[model samples]
Target: MAQNAHGGSRPGVQPVALAAAGILLLVGVLGFVPGITTDYAAMRFAGRHSEAMLLGLFQVSVLLNILHLSSGLVGLALARRIAGARAFLAVGGALYLGLWLYGFFIHRGSVANFIPVNDADTWLHLAIGFGMLACGLLISGQVGTGGRLDTPIDRP
Candidate 1:
């Protein structure tokens, strides 16, 4: 397979990043919906003051949803280039790691939980952190494998 716009195979971070971006974008938009985000009226601009929760599970706020939306946009923009894809993954990993840290230290019901993260969101952040890092690291090496490893038929 020829290199795509990102100078890598079509199965690289381009697809995964795009998917992630889309999902995050949808989640961000949905967070603003009344029923989807319970107690929408109480949604604070920032801080743990917001009682709104996305899907009535994960804590959320206006600032948090907007941040998610912006991150998704960035991810979409970077999905077309190998370098940009790698950068996006790396940055995403760092952001998730930061979120993990924030989740660990912030008071769940206090103003510290500006992101409105909860246990579920914390774990999800951890997963995103590791997954993004792995994607960037693992894919960097496979970009030019030349299909040699998969050519069993040519191993006469």
Candidate 2:
């Protein structure tokens, strides 16, 4: 299937990167909504004190939502190119994995939970982390037999 702005003859990261970015944007926006995010009023700039939970599942805060929004925007921008997309995924994935590891040390109600990550957020971060990293690592091989594996390339 021919996809992406440059057409289908290239190993594009549109599907995975775009999808991931879109989800992040959606989650970020939803987190701000009152009903969607339970206890929306409790969301704080940064701290475990924020009781806001996105979709009544993952705990969220102003800081968390902002982070999501920012990351999603960056992902969208980077997805325009294979190199950028791969970098976005790889770097972002590593950061998320780091966040996951940090979650282990930050207790549920500890003051150190500045990001206010809970069990749900923690696990989800782990999933996104590995998923992004895997996508980045494997995206290069997505181009079929005739596709150009390099960026800034135009097949004649």
Candidate 3:
């Protein structure tokens, strides 16, 4: 496997992906906590009316937290392989971007707002989409051009 300019032996993307997953999981869990998520009782499954916020900044709900956690896990799991990581980032980014679009179109107070995203969340999702995709695509692997895979072609 190729080594970075540094002496590390593993690909850089895996660590970042795993870290993102961990952070997402933490955020999801925290959103459920009363103190952490202020106005716990007012939290709803979805919609703009939900008074709960993650870090008192981003709007959140039970469904939204679950989705965030799940997406993070998927990103970490997919990071085990280069191709999988790439696909996860690309697809995940697209999904988030789509979610941002959905947030824009959906009426915040309507029943259709399942994710409970607000204006802040819509912007955040857009950032996540671009960031995740960029990280996956830009991170160099531990091995040669083909990534960390140990194949005959990569063993120069």
Top lDDT hit: 2
2 versus 3: better TM-score goes to: 2
Which ranking of candidates, highest TM-score first? 2, 1, 3
TM-score winner, 1 or 3: 1
Displacement of residue 82 (Cα, Å) in model 3 is 2.4
Off by over 4 Å in 2: 2-11, 141-145, 148-156
lDDT-better candidate, 1 vs 2: 2
Better of 1 and 2 by TM-score: 2
**What does candidate 1's lDDT look like per residue over 54-147, in tens digits?**
8988788888899889988998999878678778877887887888888988878885666778887788788878888777655642444344
Indicate which candidate wins on TM-score: 2
Task: State the lDDT of candidate 2 residue by residue for 1-156, as single tens digits.
Answer: 345455644435556788889988998899899999998888898998898989899989898999999999999999887688888888989988998998877777778899989888999999999999888887764453345456655545
Worst 10 residues of 1 by lDDT: 141-150
User: How accurate locally is residue 111 in candidate 3, as Cα lDDT from 0 to 100?
Assistant: 81
In lDDT terms, how accurate is model 3? 0.78
